[model samples]
Target: MKKTKKLFGALTLTLLLGLIVGCGSSGEDKNSADSSNKGTTDIQKIKDAGVIKVGVKEDVPNFGYMNPDTNKNEGMEPDIARLIAKELTGSEDNVEFVGVTAKTRGPLLDNGELDMVIATFTITDERKETYNFTTPYYKDEVGFLVRKADKLTDTASLDGKTIGVVQSATTKEAIEKQAKELGVSFKYQELGSYPELKTALTSKRIDAFSVDKSILTGYVDDSTEILKDGFSPQEYGIATKKANTELNDKLNKSIEQWEKDGTLEKIYKKWNLD
Candidate 1:
């Protein structure tokens, strides 16, 4: 009887110990996984793959888009991304354009789907936490794009006009804050792409498109398009996930060199933009 009781007690103790050890192992494994991914980024991956995936909007002409006539991706954003790849890997043939919307750009970068994002992304205080941003490559104001036949920006001007914006963009958030403080409400027509936004504005499905004025200058300024200034000085930068400090540092240095050597302005002229 004494031996039976001792054996039972030992068995119970062994099971408890085993479970404790199992839990500890699991916790360690989880932390290991988390730490491994913490500093991992696509910068080196892009170098290894011999191609850089750049998130850009295909609908934002000049800054980023596909020329239907040539069936080729060409724009200032593509130009900058290609230049970055060339500087990093010593080849301009490493560009892979990936379409990204205002919202998807951040998440895609975070997940390593893109090596960098040059999709007319503006720098703001809120965005700094999730991504490393390059020096401001371009600066412009915010504006509204209305149809040629519309009176949205006529005498009264966008004082009471409905503004269209993508749901998760900095532009959307900025305008929301402005509308709230001014005690005004704007009719929201959230669209998926820049092309859709353009089509919506042209068809009067939405009153106007609200975004960085740089895009406006690239798309509307030269065309038979009408734009009205809604806000001022939105700043744009090349972005990488915050884990990619090395790439960001290199890019800033390159941008400075480009500016000093007049290459940056030459790129700007190629796109006919500010």
Candidate 2:
């Protein structure tokens, strides 16, 4: 009888131990799944890290540029990036700015070197296939900045002229398309950076510098004049990796809120874009 009792007790203890071990295994698996899911989302990761790294232009004044006196990025694009960081992290200071040129920004973002890009990135059907972009924050037109001495009055006058443009930008294509429509021919010189192109224009190495009018405005002075009529209407947007639906939705919401509250208008006015 005692042997029977002992056998029953052992069986009960074994069953209890088995149940405990099974429950523990199930709990561990659930935790592991949760962690894996959390890591897959950029918004959650950014929230966990408490900072967002943004790519921005360093030479295009009034859009994104490094102020010499402050030695910090200051411009409409930077301001908009800060606003995004603020929306995500509850503080504008939670952002780290990475200087990116037209030639580098796309690759940097593609390789996960940047969390987002706000470098006056113009949205196009081709780019949309590679990345997600928020609604247009700013609208722009492509224009030409020529030495006032050149006396070039319109796009047609750029025939046979050498024009400087930043590589990897849509500027060259836009210019060529416009020239084709106008039945003119021009030579293109691709530079690695905006400052280099601006220098080329100033030094007479290129007869004209071509880009978005807002950007050209920053470099214009007594020596240069922007063509009155511009082409290639552009809509600039903040960009992230393709199919980042959650981040895209959040950014779009933030942009909508800003637009409704006149925050966007204020920023435009601050940059003299109004």
Largest TM-score belongs to which candidate?
A: 2
| lDDT (tens digit, per residue) of candidate 1 on 128-187 | 987899998787777667766665543135556777776677776777666676676676
Which stretches of candidate 2 lie above 4 Å from their native place? 1-31, 34-40
lDDT (C-alpha, whole model) for all candidates: 0.78, 0.91
Q: List the residue pairs that clash in candidate 1.
A: none
lDDT of 2 at 75: 95
Q: List the residue pairs that clash in candidate 2.
A: none
lDDT of 2 at 76: 97
lDDT of 2 by residue, 1-274 (tens): 9999999999999999999999999999999999989777879788888999999998988899999999999999999989888888889999999999887899999998899999989999999999999999999999998899888899898899998998899999998888889999999899998788889998899999999999999998888889997999999999999967899889999898999999999999999994
- Please provide TM-scores, in order, for all candidate models, with all chains considered together: 0.77, 0.87
RMSD (Cα, Å) of model 1: 5.2
* Model 1 residue 103 CA deviation in Å: 2.0
